[model samples]
Target: MDVDGEERIAAPREVVWHALNDPEILRQCIPGCQSLEKTSPTELVTTVRIKIGPVGATFNGEITLSNINAPESYTISGEGKGGIAGFGKGAADVVLIEDGDETILRYAAKAQVGGKLAQLGSRLIDSASRKLAQQFFADFNAAVAADGQT
Candidate 1:
């Protein structure tokens, strides 16, 4: 499945870009993220707990940032394994455009899932995916915006 959207964050592009790379900020922004450890400048290992429908699972994943353009844009990719629950892999192309004092954060993401998670039906999975994405960006936007205020 694919999902895309944009958020207007009340912060400069540089601030938003820095927040995107901060493990602490990302851990707080991501829904269900249990832990996020930065292993390298562009790589992180994470654990996230999520429930879709009635199946609840903990996913261990690795995230990588590439195609970086510094304070501008980058591609974020990750894959997670949830044991019997399923496996998921996805990539997102994120672009940060400066809009005066704020930043317009746009993303195009593609994802795929297998195992029990896929058996849940496409409609359900798609809906859940969109909701999760929205939640993450909303939280991220708020966090960055609040930080800018201080």
Candidate 2:
């Protein structure tokens, strides 16, 4: 599945960039993310719980950032396993464009699933992925805006 979207954040590009790299901020913004630990400047280990259709499971994953260009752009890829539920892997390219005091965040992502999760059908998985992406961005925008105010 492919997913892409853009969001306008009421903060500077630098602030947005920092928030994106900060594990604490990411943990707060990512939907279903139970914990996120940054093991290195370019890698993070995470635990996330999600429910799709009639199945619910917790997934452990590692995400790595590459082709980083500071407050400009980067590519992130990760894979997760949920035991009997299934597994998922995906990659996203993110760009941050400065718009005066605000920043325009854009992303293009693709994901794949296997096992029981894949058996649930593409339509269902696509819908769920889109929703989760939307939620994460909304939360991220709000959190960054709020953080800027403090």
Candidate number with greatest lDDT: 2
lDDT of 1 by residue, 67-112 (tens): 9999999999999999999999999999999999999999999999
Q: For candidate 2, what is the TM-score?
A: 0.98
Tell me how far the alpha carbon of residue 84 in candidate 2 is from the true structure, in angstroms, after superposition. Answer: 0.6
As a whole number from 0 to 100, the lDDT of residue 134 in candidate 1 is: 88
Which ranges in model 2 have alpha carbons more than 4 Å from their true place?
none
- Candidate 1's C-alpha lDDT? 0.94
- Predicted candidate 2 versus true structure: per-residue lDDT over 18-46, tens digit per residue: 99999999999888999999999999999
TM agreement with the true structure for every prediction: 0.97, 0.98
**RMSD, every candidate, angstroms:** 0.8, 0.7
